[model samples]
Target: MDIRRYAPLRAAGASWKDIAAQAGCDWRTAKKYLSPDAPAVPPRATSRAGTVSRLVDPFTDVIDAWLADDPGLLATVIHERLVADYGFTGHYQRIKVYCAEARRRIELESDAQGRPPGLHRRFEVVAGAQAQVDWGDEGCLLVGAGAGKKVYSFHMTLSYSRDPFICFTTSQDLATFFDCHRRAFAHFGGVPATIVYDRTKTVVRRHVAPGRAVPLHPQAAAFAEHYGFAIDVLAAHRPTGKGRVERQVQIGRDHVLSGRRFSSLAELDAAFAAWVPIRRGQVHRTHGEVIAVRAVRDHAALGPLPQFGYAVTETHLRRVGRDALISFAGSSYSVAARAADGRVTKAGQRVEVRVGVEHLEIWRLPVDSPDRTPMLLARHPLAAVRGQMIVDPQHWAELPDGHTRSTTLDITDHAPVAAQQVPGDPTPSSVSGSMVFGESQAALEVMVARRPLAYYDRLAGLAAPPEPATTAETTTSESLVGAA
Candidate 1:
């Protein structure tokens, strides 16, 4: 309160009560301030310094040990450990406050590796000299009918221009990984000199001992060779080696997908496509130039793409099942029983399967052929959902089934026998080499002709029975037929 304002009022014959009422202060304070020589004294401000709760003091050493072991340990986790193991009777906020200071101390002391946290070389690559790549796990998305599928994003950011390219996929297999690389290169209009990647299995065949030569994935090597770029595989636990793309991964999630819901991979990709231009127009923090403008210089310095596009397909050897099906990508695809060259693909025969992002090709292995060339067996569009069976009806044509019985009869062996007749009956005439046994039907049927009892007696190798006398009409017809 300023006492000078009430001083004039006090000198004008105002009582202490009246001055206190006017000044909104107590009457005793008004009497002191209203005095002629009373000096204005601002209220002394007081503050209580914040300190770690005394309740947590007992557990400070344990907390420090945990923090030193892992500087990134969360406060809630520490609080839980303290409550469960240390019998700490403190609120979570106290533990949180303590952890903040503890973490700062740990960070200042240096990381667990005994290196200062801030001691690192900041790098800036020349235009088109290098690009970084990484994958972001976007969790599950309801694609169709609320069926959830794991979604992932492929990110590539030019180290110089900060130009970013992102695409969404349902898979992170070797084929899909390079397929996204091809797309990113195309979007940037050329390939960089070196592409930096963390030791993803797609990029690195296996983890090798430190200082040993890293073995690059065969397909990755081929892809990089085809695109005229070098594969720079970062060491384990070295995310900062490709920090440009690592940061872009988060930027993509925050700017494009933070508040959006997508029904399909296409929609998610479209969201990225729409945001990329907006990102390019903004001034980059490090480069201090519009990303699109800097991207032009980067694109101009990049190496030209190869004349032919590299086929990004993951090749695997699969044995054809007895059912002429080959299992792949959690689904089964049918291969033709009879190959194009008229060779039958029997069970247990290994075939080469080249799986692409959207389709898969089955090739018959040339195991014992004069020309060692694989024959294309079948091509099928990939299944939309897992556990699906993709079948071609024609592929099962040569395979036997229960419904393949024939309806025709062959009687050429029995054609030479002459027709026999009984007494007083016209003899049946034989035709051609085959006989019409019965009416056309699914099952073959034969009609048996009746013969005299004497013929059966002769065929039994017994004494021939005496022949009975024939009627005159039968005798005349028989004689006329014999004469003709």
Candidate 2:
């Protein structure tokens, strides 16, 4: 103790004997205390008996059981459950400390006895042989009214070259799904022999047990047949089967969409299109070749496009309304009252509607004679907004107007016009030689028919005369005409 206190003074040039005299110890004793070989530090036993207990010590078994059940169980959760169930009145810190150590011990033990994770071998295919497809959720990229709408990216990556194509859409419907495929094919200028896909409902009709044949959607099969390619559906829950496109989904989001605000799907797609050139210029880590250069070889090996484009149209049956309108996708589209061949289209008749990406066609097929050709009723651009009514003014041309198909009798059709005329009546030539009496009569009739009868009837009440038998039918026809 004396040497320890006087060490600083001695090192500061103080004499040892003088330091001892100041320390109230003999100079010889001080010298022995300062000896180099003397034991300056005390030694203790290497082991100790258990003297203290932890609050978690009693609950150690319970803690271990919980950790065995769920390795990732939170310490706070354990503490809460322990306090409620076990009557353990301990601070959360004690439980947290114990759980951490217990989890670590359990993890080590589990790792020592656990089986190794499954591993997959890296795969490669020849140029143009294979492509992988996947969809990514971009999560509400649009602004304003569409801000809540989720944006999705459809990705196709050539397995050999790692060349990627992406297009943004708001829907994952079958039409949008295949439309994206068409766009991808056009981007590559040819089609790969096989396209890998997850079991999306658009591609797979229904899921089946493993080791069984997977059923493909009918339109999907037809599309593949037309394009001369095969659909390779990945095994259930195996995203790694199409890892190329799966990885590309994240890559596209990071490289092109990250930190950017897109108000529309087209803007998002354009951003990806602009970044594609840069991506192709860089060397891919797996392939070790510039994507653009490798893509050239891939494109060259691809099969030629078919002579005719596959019709990416979805067909549905819709009944023509009395107004010559059909409802589809929450919008109303006009169909001509008469087909192109002059065959009349009646209300409540079921017509086939072929819906395309940007347009739709209404066809009146011959139900009575299947061999007879289907008549095209109308072709119209799809409505931009839902609940909109897309009308073609010409579709209503054949409705019962005064000049054509009028309920009013045509005097010439029933009898000779000259014989029907009375002798006292003014001659048609006396009125005006250049004027057409038939046209005048039709115009007068149309004007009188437009006058509303409801107001007059409401005013007259019980005094109103008995209505004509055809009044109800006439009213319905007029309403339909007004709607058209």
Candidate 3:
């Protein structure tokens, strides 16, 4: 009955009589069905095939128009359109098959032109000799405790070493930007021979007549100069020149920064520092050694550090407020009182406050002063007052109860009496006070238990008692009475 079953019987040269007996059919019936040369039985007509043709032929024109315009249109959409427009009632599978064939035809036509060309490969640079520097803004997030924290990711990569250093910060100002470089240098323990950079506004002044290298942004130039290294800028719009660092930025985002939580910038920075060592220890798939080890071998070829810190010109001028304040890194710092209402010009590491033409050096600035207490204020005061505390055992009882206030008074008492006098100048005064054996509590208990009976009588009268005299004051009073 089927072609596959009859083909083997005919191929074996079995007569129709034997085939009929094996197949359980009459000889005449088997002969009529199995004979390949028997006039083909006039090609029996299939009702189902006719039904399929009828359903597809009616929608062929509409399907062709849709395929020409949008070959990506789904089969279900085409079927619905056909049913609404042309009264199509075929199953969805047939339309899907037809659409697939149409898509194949479209693809064949599109690829007939062929691809343009393969990417051109360039000469490779020596390993660890150079590095590329650039910044990428990876959006902002609230990253600190409580609320309203600002954070940004800073990315850097070595051109030849392919080592990457990523950091998170609340600022992109010169201080933080330079600080990141310092950290990176310290991490690798040496500076790169030549650092390639892009024309960021923070680093590039101008295009220098269309295509020439723009002068380095003063601060960035100073950083390079301090380290005794050279900086080269890539041609504008040619990001591929710095492709190594760019690729590293993506890798860092995927592996280190993604799905990590940090409560503060300090916390994030600590986590990043921890991650750097792990990243550095990993052997590059292309190169054999770890990136950190490679950088160390390459660092020996670098130049020595410069003697003087590099000088940088001011890029912007901002006015100091009446409160002696200037803003940087989304935080405020107060200059000296003399520098208030003056013009403050910032150049990389230095901030010069000008009153007319004269420059006032600002010794200290308050960094952490929100609604909360400022930590820098306390630290600065402590540093300024170090090594000036009085340590006399006799006057310990007369000192104040509060530790900070007591320490402050001790420094004041031991300070030079005359403005021009240097430290350790002796004062001609006798010291006589109870030596408090322990802390303030012990001294207070002794004073309460050992007070004279006359002292309580004076207190009961509610009268001002005679003032106690120091040894010098008593001697002066007696001498004055004798003179009188």
Candidate 4:
């Protein structure tokens, strides 16, 4: 049967009945074979042309080469090439079939050759059991005029709970490190069973050898001891082991730190304090509850705070001056009078002054003085000074021989001299051009003129001029003062 000849007859619209009768076959056989609905037989064209075997051989290699040059090259190109070069005149769909088979072979080969070598373990964590910690740098800026501020953020996360805490500090020193941890633990309202950390130089010394253990730095060990928790050190350079904190650090930078602007470390800390509560209250997709709620539940499982306080203490080395006082952060405090001429150690939240087996509490010095010197006195002397400073001069009139007017004159005479001598400077002093004293009527007039209207009005409403000094008291004071 010539299918090509039938093609022209089929295109011309000749009925199956007409073709079957002309072909001299039984009507039933003709209808069964020629009807469009009849099952298709294999093409006879290829068999007659004797080209089928060559077209099928090496078909995969041909398709692969064409695809390698351009994976998106059309199947029609291959079909056209086959027709022009190898006399392939089969239907277009036959070429498509070969192309699909070729694609399957290439994919199988790629799977065998390019697949990753080993399986990856999924990350799993226990809720509230452990946490990860890391430090990230934030660049320096002038927080205030003449105030150079450099800040770093301490980041922590509970492994399973994905709860996060961040604290910004001006230093990464041991004290700051401990302070951050203390605040973080308090914020979470409990401590994790274990804390994971990178091999930071602040925490760990150098590794003993590759694949071996490293020693923990003493300060860091003390911090862990204070918190009463064990530390897990990730392998060197393996930050992914502490993936929770690493991810938290990034999120903190984007969501917390970047969203706010601050003018000082204190301001930044305040802003972070406000942000942390909101962050803890946010629902975690995996945990299905807010971090704060989960943390509270876990807190019940945590061990109680130590009977003896183990919280970190700030340490500072200060040199005691000849007056037996040490200066710290622009304030001076007494150690031992003998402690002068040597270095002394101080530690604790309050200034601790060590005087030969005894600890002295340093009183906060007044900021109003021209010289903001911290006054470190023996406890008894401090008590007396406090009593005297607190008592009003007007109230001193009740004391024996303490006439208020004479007392006022004595205080005024000694005020500037006492101020100069307290700072221990003996240099000769002179009043500046701007320094006006009330000794001269002209100077007093200038002072009154310069005084604010409110002050002058308040002074005018006073009951009377301060009682004039008694002549007997003045003559006695003049005689005593002249003797000096």
Winning candidate number (lDDT): 1
Worst 10 residues of 4 by lDDT: 441-450
Better of 1 and 2 by TM-score: 1
For residues 1-484, what per-residue lDDT tens digits would candidate 4 score against the true structure? 5432454564588776677666655556556665667557723423544445644454656668887666657788888887788767677787887777666666456454554422334576555678889998876633555155567889888777677778887667655676687778877777778888887876786666545777998767876787778988876545678877888888887876674566776676676677777878899877688878876766666555555545443334444344445554444444432112232323322333322211224432324123565544223122211113222233223235534443213323342321121111112223322344345512211111122344444466743334455788567645543432
Error in Å for residue 268 of model 1 = 2.5
Q: Evaluate residue 201 in candidate 4 and report its C-alpha lDDT on the 0 to 100 scale.
A: 70
Model 2: weakest 10-residue lDDT segment is 424-433
**Per-residue accuracy of model 1 over 361-449 as CA lDDT, tens digit each:** 99977773448887899999999887999999899987777796756555543333444555433443333333454665233234344
Error of 2 at 196 (Å): 0.2
RMSD after CA superposition, every candidate: 14.4, 15.0, 19.8, 21.7
Residue 17 alpha-carbon offset, candidate 1, angstroms: 57
Best by TM-score: 1
Q: Write the per-residue lDDT of candidate 2 for residues 248-329, one digit (tens) a residue.
A: 9899989998888877877888898899999999999987999999999999999988888886678899998888899999
Candidate 3 total steric clashes: 1
Candidate 3 scores a C-alpha RMSD against the true structure in Å of 19.8
Clashing pairs in 1: none
The superposed Cα distance between candidate 1 and the true structure at residue 55, in angstroms, equals: 17
User: What is each predicted model's overall lDDT from 0 to 1?
Assistant: 0.82, 0.80, 0.59, 0.59
Candidate 2 clashes between residue pairs 3 or more apart in a chain or in different chains = none
Clashing pairs in 3: 203-217
In candidate 1 the C-alpha lDDT for residue 148 amounts to 78
